[model samples]
Target: MSIQTSRRALLAAAALAAPAIWGRDAVAQIRRGDELTVGIWGGAQERITRQFCATPLERQHGVKINYVLGGTPERRARAYAERGRPSFDLLYLNIFESRQAVKDGVTMASSANVPNFANLYDIAKIGGYAVAFNPVTIVYDRRKVAAPMTSWRDFWRDDLKGKVIWPTYPGAQGTSALLMAAKVWGGSESNIDPAFTNIARLRPFAAIQGSQDQLYGMFDQDVGAASVEFGSFTRKYAETRNPNIVIADPTEGQAIATNVACITTGTRNQALAEAFVNLHLSPECQAAYAEEIYYSPTIKNVSFAPELAAKLILGEAAVNKLVDFNWDLVIANQPRWSSRFTREIAG
Candidate 1:
């Protein structure tokens, strides 16, 4: 049978068996015509997710999807504030926010809810079920820098001083940059002193940017030469806005925080939530998402088209070059790190 047919059969069997294995209540919780609210970022990410996953699933199953779109900070804050009565059943969060969700007791355990969770990489199967990623590395105006950057340490290059942008601490890209600094500057998750010292030293040269919006006009306005940005965004920007923009894979590695989809504790339709998360991880959906949005899928086997192969993180060789951080460790020391970043790095 076809994949969709098999899925329908599985749903039919599961619904019939749930009453005996789980309870009548669990079966009733996600009956036909139910709507599953999913919290995620807005813009391209939202549109692509709908095209690749939400719309398809809604058609396959008798269900609806409601998108709760916002910034990562807003979604994270709301997930925490609502707690047991969250407005969303599914949340798409980055590695740090996913861990925070677990710590705050707002997400369901994937081991119990999502059967396909085992198919993801160990890193993807963390506090939340990682569905996608955007590998962040060096993005520069090729016209400005004669020689290509080959190391993460290139961020501190004196020749490129005052031309680089520093991400503020406590944000996704910011924390990833911190971990990058620590790794290349002789520090690790256990020791971040090197990262801080380097940040303080580079503060005078590197301008701090809170969001990508600030970096959009960097080249045209001459605010700076280049900035650390996600390869996905930079590639699209290069194609559409600035052909001068080019992404460099630091020999050290590009730091990426996996984006995950998790069922929240307050979900009234738990079964539908789990299935939606599972379907989002399917290779068909993942491939469509990767091609449409340029974010890497967490699946082990999906491949991109030839034209996209060089631009996106795909295949084993590229995947191995990814740098991951210890979110728990980052959060534990965030109080001190955030203060120092404000007083020293951005001061």
Candidate 2:
């Protein structure tokens, strides 16, 4: 092994007080009846997590998992407000929120804490250990959008005029969409002027939705042909509610981010928290998440069933077609971005 890998292995060995299982450290701190809380988005996500992740952890490690279910925004609010005393041990927060969590001294730093971190894709490690990919893309009602939408710029096509919607700012999908817009339209995170200018022009002809449900509702009514949302989210809504709705792989690529997992800084159960974090990156957990939820896995070379693999954003071909943004920039200038979207785009 290389020097770095040996050192990481030693670090993991020193931390675990018991034998390893499944090629991962199983520390004594994760004893029977000991509990670990995991915050996740409610509804379908929580369902899949319980069946695939929580049950197995409980069965194997004798650790009880208490899932704290809420909307992403609500859970993030709790994470920030609680900080040193977060209600959960492991929270599934967006990359931006996770990055902010680490900056605010809320995350346990280093791959040493979550040893499986070393097994993840490089992009997934950027803002803590990303557990799942959330590719923000152009979602449309296939029946209404006869031609495949080519790009975010397609929202402005003459045929789509007054028949398009824009995600409202201060929302993750919207913020990402606008940022993607800025970059593609000769503006950038540092210079969002052209983006706002063009957005203002499109405003009069576009509908604006503040939440995913509202966006889905607008699509149901044929109020718009396309809008921005995470690929997995689009799939979820399509399978359960709107069969005609589908994700459009834009020629310019989809804007990608992730739902990251981390052990909070002040956890009373640090070792168990770290263990659970490792399980999240485990091939088992990663595969379930990919297959069940359709969110891309972060671990390198995870094996998904053939049908499941078809639903995933896997392989180099799809990975190369994803657009990534600077989370630091997104987190830092959020206020200005929100204000611009409200004043210039939503007006």
Candidate 3:
């Protein structure tokens, strides 16, 4: 079926299910002692979620929450392919995958149980499928680099050649990095030629498919001078080892690379899934997770911890500077760009 038709059907289903699960009293039909399964990313995010959301949820609702960890899109797709017998009720996806997941019937439509839906920044409500968990920022070692490394333009400098590291292409973080380059080089759209040209210039410094572990290791060892990584990573790195490490707000802008939560369409425990979605958006949950993980909170009135708040990219002013990326354009051209990058830029 077409995506619109599917969305309409899901909306209809949600409308029908709402009153049954959440009447005027706002209580779901899920009985006490029942269990709900949630699928989240395995590492840091999971730890934060369990500490902030899961344990509290179980205590409050008397429902056991089974936490499952895996690669977000792959696991969600596998659940859908199983013909609606979803192994997990909720899934965590990045922005791009959240869009595609909703289109693919992997997620249910948003419901009223998600209380902080109104608290979201406009960007967090994109296509009504997912919400932002944090804003990504540019990071550098202040002591090692004498000049202020404020923008993508700084990475292209001759002085940093063969000393920079970046994430792999086609990922949102990598795509945003490319868009940042495009913005600096005068092609902010998905034309990508200018971005590739910039990539070509930085090819000598490039490290492909590098994980956070590898990048942090490199930074610790001083093998790489700088990298464009998630704000959370930067904040944690700064807090733990390098007080000299600094996050920059570019004159051009920064992207809020996000981890979004969505309820699956085929969940056996719809109420529980919706509750989990609600928990994710709650001010308490958002604040707790933000402090623990150093990700920016999406809830409007909530404040992150002082140290984390300093690192977060909150408010309209910061959001305004971000590239209004065309996801459709990027997805359409990704293969072409990937092929060209492997041949020309990587060569």
**CA lDDT scores, all candidates in order:** 0.73, 0.73, 0.66
Q: Which candidate ranks first by TM-score, i.e. highest? A: 1
List of clashing residue pairs for candidate 2: none
User: Could you tell me every candidate's TM-score relative to the true structure?
Assistant: 0.86, 0.85, 0.84
Please write out the lDDT profile of model 2 over residues 1-347, one tens digit for every residue: 11122334433332342222434445535667788888888876776556545665677667788988787777777777888987778787787777777888777554755667777777777656888887888898777664778788877777776777888887778877888788779988788787787777675644888888899888878888888888887797899999998788888888887888767778776667766677566665565566556888877756655766777788667776778777778778989878777777776
Q: Which stretches of candidate 3 lie over 4 Å from their true place?
A: 1-21, 24-28, 127-132, 304-307
* Lowest lDDT 10-residue stretch of candidate 1: 13-22
Candidate 3, residues 50-92, lDDT tens digits: the string is 6545666566667788887787657757666854667767777
Candidate 2 segments exceeding 4 Å error:
1-28, 110-115, 305-307
lDDT of 1 at 204: 62
In candidate 1 the C-alpha lDDT for residue 99 amounts to 72
- Residue 279, candidate 1: how far off, in angstroms? 2.3
lDDT of 1 by residue, 192-302 (tens): 889989877775654677777677665556667667777777777777888887788888888876778877886788777777676677665666556656778786755
TM for candidate 2 is 0.85
Query: In model 1, what lDDT does residue 289 have?
Result: 59
